[model samples]
Target: MTALTLENFLPYRLSIASNAVSDAVASAYRALFGLKIPEWRLVTILAEGGAMSQQALCGRTRMDKVTVSRAAIALSERGLISRASNPGDQRSHLLTLSKAGWELYEEVAPKALELERQVFAGFSDAERQLLREMLDRIETAVERLEAKG
Candidate 1:
């Protein structure tokens, strides 16, 4: 029989590590670009995937609908992103990177990459690859459980 200790739980440890990393990078993003983590995520995703509806953004970002909506609204208000009528979905609007959004992405992407490099500087290439694969496996496991429920 194993004693249950929250500190020793793999899920707890993963959550703690995730929060710590997010917090550290979030501070840099806020300081450098005045963008919150959610806003930065939307910008990065849109830059890579082009215009998408809020529902699609939620799936692509693994963010809740409300969070994605709020980020979209914020970005739109700032003129970084634009919202347009979605021809395919009347209930949803498509979000696209405006000229300003593209400009901001261009500026932020390099800094974001540099921050990523710094965070993984202690990790070897193999370690990083393994960590990423482990995360993907964890996500898959979670999705499997979610699908069951």
Candidate 2:
């Protein structure tokens, strides 16, 4: 039988590392902009992808619908994002960053990138690329497994 240990498990280690990075990013965003992880994710995605539906945001971010909905409601209340009628689906509205949100994003983006650099400061450019590729491969493998089920 194969020996199993949580500490040595690939998924466990990945989750731990991911949480550490997310915590660091979340703390900085909260301190600088009073935004949580979900809210920041929405802002970043909207800034990059332009207006999109909540469902699309969920698919892009891989975040659950409830989390996305709460973030959208919070951002809308703060006047950081606006909701417009979706042409194809009247029941759903498209979300976009407001002028204020864009201004905040402009300030936040550089800081976020700098924080990412800090997190991976010891890694070489090649190592970073490899890390990205490895993550993509893991995701692809997971998709295949899920599709088989």
Q: Estimate each model's TM-score.
A: 0.96, 0.97
Report the number of the highest-lDDT candidate.
Answer: 2
Candidate number of the best TM-score: 2
Q: Give the poorly placed runs of model 1, Cα more than 4 Å off.
A: none
TM-score of candidate 2 against the unseen true structure: 0.97
Q: Looking at candidate 1, what is the lDDT of residue 148?
A: 100
lDDT for model 1, on a 0 to 1 scale?
Answer: 0.94
Per-residue CA lDDT of candidate 1, range 1-149, in tens?
98999999999999998899899989999999889999999999999999899999999999998999889989999999998999998988889999999999999999988988998999999999999999999999999999999
Candidate models: Cα lDDT each: 0.94, 0.97
